[model samples]
Target chain A: MSLASRELPSVAATMAPPRSPADTPAGAISGPSWLNNLRAMLAKELLLEWRNLSRLGSVALFGAVTLVLFSFVAPPQAGARRMATAGFLVLALLLSSTLSLSESFRKETHHRALTGLLLVPVAPSAIFIAKAFANFFQLVLLAPVLIPVALVLFSVDLTATSGVSYPLLQLLAVWALASAGLAAPGTLYAAMTSDLRGRDVVLPLLFFPLVVPVLLAAVKATALVLSGDAMGQLGSWNLLLLIFAVVHGTLGTVLFGYAVEES
Target chain B: MRGKFQWEHAVLLLALVLLTVGTYIGLAVAPPERHMGDVQRIMYVHVPTAWIAMLSLTVAFVAAIGSLWSGKHKWDAAVVGSTETGVVLTGLLLSQGMIWARATWGVWWDWDVRLTTSLVMFILFAGVLALRASVDSAERRASWSAVAIIVAYADVPLVYFCVRWWRSLHQVQSTPETVDAAMMLPLRINAFGMLFLATWFIVRRARLELAQRQVEETTLPERRSVEEVQHA
Candidate 1:
């Protein structure tokens, strides 16, 4: 909308500026081309994340260490073991998502780095989608590395008996949905907060609440899956995940443009 | 123009009087429910406070949208002020809910969907306010807080729907058909009265806050001049 220039044109005459020269890309901006753009943006986002290797490494290490510590505290019973597996899985997802999503817009805001990105031919929605995708991928990648350690520490069997296949998929779905929910608004707020004093504190303050629904759903669904409850229940969890993802994705896309412009 | 009371102020005062009378009527005059007993009286306050909480969040969302669309500091301030009021009202409602629960449900808390969602809403409100306080720059704080407000608020209905969609211990809505004539009058009156009170609070606080900021802006140059003279 900002790309449109006004000359007292009629409403019908007013049109948004095209990011791609092709008219086809204009419509595709909502579909596959956006997906491709999202993938590329995600790749760039991942590279940006990898640049902060120390932070990422510490977070992963902290997650593993936390699981190891929790194992000792949990009651040494079969039911407790069942509970521990879910708890550790949730712990890993929470650690990775919160840590990464909290910093989702860090690179963009540092030294007005985001302004340079905005000058590129990318759409604002694309930027959000890309950031969300990258964060989700990173959380996923970070999770598997902890899974084996968590299983050993929590005494979980990752076999067919574990029945984690459906749950794992469900958990992954929740994680991706939760990451998008967090990162979408988070990236925008981080950009705004980073420009203010004491960003060290403000970032988390802005992020935690915006993602509570995601956190609640993710925690519940993941816990259910890890507990290997009735398969029938997964349908409901998946529905919740779908609703969360769609709502966040739509809200994020529509509003990211405003945040970027204001930032 | 500035010295005289406006019609809006008169309306607010009338609403306050009505609220006081309504509370007296609710607590003193209304017949107690056979099931909930005297504790049911709390519904007059509890239900209204919960309504205000919901209203506050909605206003915050609207303010965020206004700020984003118009880029006004006043809109941002209203959003922040409404959010604070919402958080306080939510805390009150939660306490009242707990008291009512003890009298009615035997347990102080049940983790019911509605109650849990309300708790989550308060957490979101508190977090946003904390973020607003920690940031030093007015412009950056306003912009960022507005973004958070909008995003969080947009999820509110989803949360409500999610709770409603699930089977939970929390009782669903009590329709007009279900409610007796005695409870309906106070419920309706207090609901409107709370809206009036909430609007007055948000407007008055927003104006006072804006005036204070303007005072600071106007004084900055004078303060700078004093410092220069002292150095000289």
Candidate 2:
């Protein structure tokens, strides 16, 4: 079924004459079908991103340029350069993620699409989850391009150095977990600021301070992995990253309904 | 209302008196530390400011919960007042810390757990105030800020833990056991003085906010009616 037809009953109940017996059953039935509504919303988000591929391309380009600038500013010593690679890479991802988040929510506000989404009968948390997943997916796609460019530009030796191994698997794991940490809060803040003036300026002000733990843990984990101490030194930082992800993800999901309500 | 003002005035006066006595004790009565000498006097202000900063933010956090639970504007005012006070204290703490660090650690800044967490807390609550300012509607601002404060406060422990586990170049937390008894007088006095001053600030600011909100509530409908008459 088309998305509009599926949402019509809920929208109709909200707009139509009050509490007729005929509409009451439809409203009650629709409230319990939030799972299907969530799936449809998630699909719509992905489809939207796929159709507008340029957004993804621009984010990738932004990350690439940031990486280049960082490399130039970095120390020239091979040892020092290797040590700084992970930090620079995470910084690039963070700056690019901020831009993407601002753009995503600005579009929603410009088109008044967020209000329409809120009008759907689905739980508001579903909208948050879907948007977070869309952001996480975009970051995942950018990681391949950004990581390789960073590794080459910084002259990082990813091969096992001394007693530790710097495997590709560990690097990807850290990237994914860190991206999840960033995306959950990023999407929530994007929603919170989208309706306000100077939202672009406000997002970073509110976002960076809150995400310090994430950046700290991610940079630490990436550093450990790159230095070939992945298993030994990474355990606690990994746990911290997991906690950061879970706390933010759960908070964003629960509070998002309240955040976006009556906006 | 007159009685309330009297109590507030009394508290402010007591804080001022204690502050004067505390500075005297901190400068003259307390003996200098053997290691750092007189430069350690900065601790009299620094420690109290740090304590009050954290205490004020904790107050704001509780007020946030109350605002969300009761949906009362008074709680919102409390949050705003305490949060603004906390931000000011945090700024003072950072400045005091920089001076102390310069004397003790020989550096203006260090990435130690306490120092980093203080910086993070300052930025987070300042952001809260900024978020409060950006929104137009009072009700919307209150609810959104309540949620934001809760989220930011929740991250405090995590920031502390991350910084602690990563590495610490600064000394471990100071407790009564570590501090000499002779040094404790000024520290205790200043702590109480800072507490009273912070409470006075919060109470006065909260009253101002509530009065402003009341004015808006009273005038908004009249303004709307005037607009309606114009349209008619």
Q: TM-score for each prediction?
A: 0.82, 0.89
lDDT of 2 by residue, B1-232 (tens): 4445456768888999999999999999999887778987898888899999899999999999898777799999999999999999999899888887777778999886888899999999999899999987787788889889988998999999988977744467432245788788999999999999999999998988999899888878877678558534
lDDT by residue (tens digit), candidate 2, A1-263: 13433443443334323244544322222353455456666876786677657778989999999999999999999899999998999999899999888866766664355666666444677778888998888888888899999999998767855445546778888888888888988898899898787788788999999989989899988888888673587877888888998999898987887788763
Please give the TM-score that candidate 1 achieves against the real structure.
0.82
Best by DockQ: 2
Candidate 1 per-residue lDDT over residues A1-263, each given as its tens digit:
11111211221121234456763443245775565556555656665555556666777787787777778787889778766576566656665656666565654554444554455435678777776666666666666667677767776654434445655566566656655655555655655565555776766665665555565566666666666655556567657766777777787777776666633
- Candidate DockQ values, in order, are 0.40, 0.70
Candidate 2 structure lDDT:
0.82
Local distance difference test scores for all models: 0.67, 0.82
Model 1 chain B: ten consecutive residues of lowest lDDT: B168-177
What are the RMSD figures for all models against the true structure? 7.7, 4.6
Off by over 4 Å in 2: A1-32, A161-166, B1-6, B168-177, B221-232
The segments of candidate 1 whose C-alpha lies over 4 angstroms from its true place after superposition are: A1-43, A49-55, A120-122, A160-178, B6-8, B161-177, B219-232
**Which pairs of residues collide in model 1?**
none
Worst 10 residues of 2 chain A by lDDT: A23-32
